[model samples]
Target: MEVNIRHARAGVTIAVDGLAELRELEWHDGHVRIGAGLNLTEIERRLDGRIPLMAEWFPQFASRLIRNSATLGGNIGTASPIGDSPPTLLALDASLILASREGEREVALADFFRGYRQTELRDGELIRAVKIPLPLAPITGFYKYAKRRFDDISSVAVGIALELESDNVRRIRIGLGGVAATPIRALKAEEALAGKPWTKRNVREAARVMGQEGTPLSDHRASADYRAAMLEQALLKFFFEKSEVVRG
Candidate 1:
């Protein structure tokens, strides 16, 4: 519930944790709504079994101290290209609710980011909550490659969501981060894998397409080539690790 002071010249910094509306978390019949003010640790605890993918990736996030302080809303508000949560949220087809004095509006997480640290949030609008549709027997995976195993931003991060229908990929979504100006859905890669038989060959081909989905850049964390390679390998790794679940 603590907010950081980022502006050295700022005259005043007001605390909004007392705002009741922003601190509420609600569970519905077919979906869950998470308030913007809830910290990562709180969210993971509440959504543990209901949203297993979050638990799968939560350990790879920052240290416990940071998780206690960092809010999910703050992470999305920054709209950073390498944010760990955005890609996973996008893969789940999440929608963000933005509220203002005028009214509340919903935007798909896939369409949320406009550019590096940019989003569709307009003046006077603030993120109220994030809503995700429930998936029946979903198989999800998240992978992050960073300088350190923990507390470091990813050089490449991938999130995959799959619903299988008897060894065939009935539906699939792929999300990638740190390889472009914004976190992005690998639509072409998803298209390549959808409706295809769940096999190593099919996944490998789809991964090749995934490597072409983003325009990667060379940076201190990794070279452009390395990032792209990791992107492809991440897909393969996820599929292989979940092969039993995928086949079932």
Candidate 2:
């Protein structure tokens, strides 16, 4: 109250400590239902091996101290364009469950964000849990570029989820952050790669398309051109990594 009053702002703050539904972290069938209130450390520890993409990405969050107190739900609720988890979740085809006194509703993670820091969440409603479907694509990758490797925010980030049949791209989803008003799927890039041979040439072409999906801006962390270049390189890096895995 003192802080708010001194800062010339409303001092109201609601504590949702009693919301039991927002604390659940459980596996249903093959997928996992992660409560919004669950801290990052807990989410990281439990998701190891179970959801490899999440395991890899969670460590890239701020710092250990921040992770201890930061909640997965809080991150999603903030809806920052550069949020680490959103791109990864978008690639994984995740969904969020929202609850209100009326009932509960499911919203696709990709469709959850309406604009900068805005979401489909309604008044009097809260995020219940996040649903991560099981058996992620055989080839999954995440990459982010930041001024500082660890605690800093990303200048650009990419997440790739690809299912291959022989040497051809069976299915693919690419998620990008820090390049648009909201985290978005590079659907045009995905279309360029899908059903085509997973080759350097195809990957390169799709990467070109990837660079065109979002409207990036120049900021302190990086310039717009640099971010666009990184977007292309990120997808190519993931492609090469998957190729190495297949060869090995």
Compare the candidates by TM-score and give the number of the best one. 1
Looking at model 2, residue 55 earns an lDDT score of: 73
TM per candidate comes to 0.94, 0.93
lDDT of 1 by residue, 176-208 (tens): 889999999999999998898989999999999
Runs in model 1 deviating more than 4 A are 1-8
Clashing pairs in 2: none
- Worst-scoring 10-residue span by lDDT in model 2: 1-10
Model 2 residue 105 lDDT? 98
Candidate 2 residue 120 Cα shift, in angstroms, is 0.4
| Alpha carbon lDDT at 171, candidate 1 | 91
- Report per-prediction Cα RMSD to one decimal: 2.4, 2.6
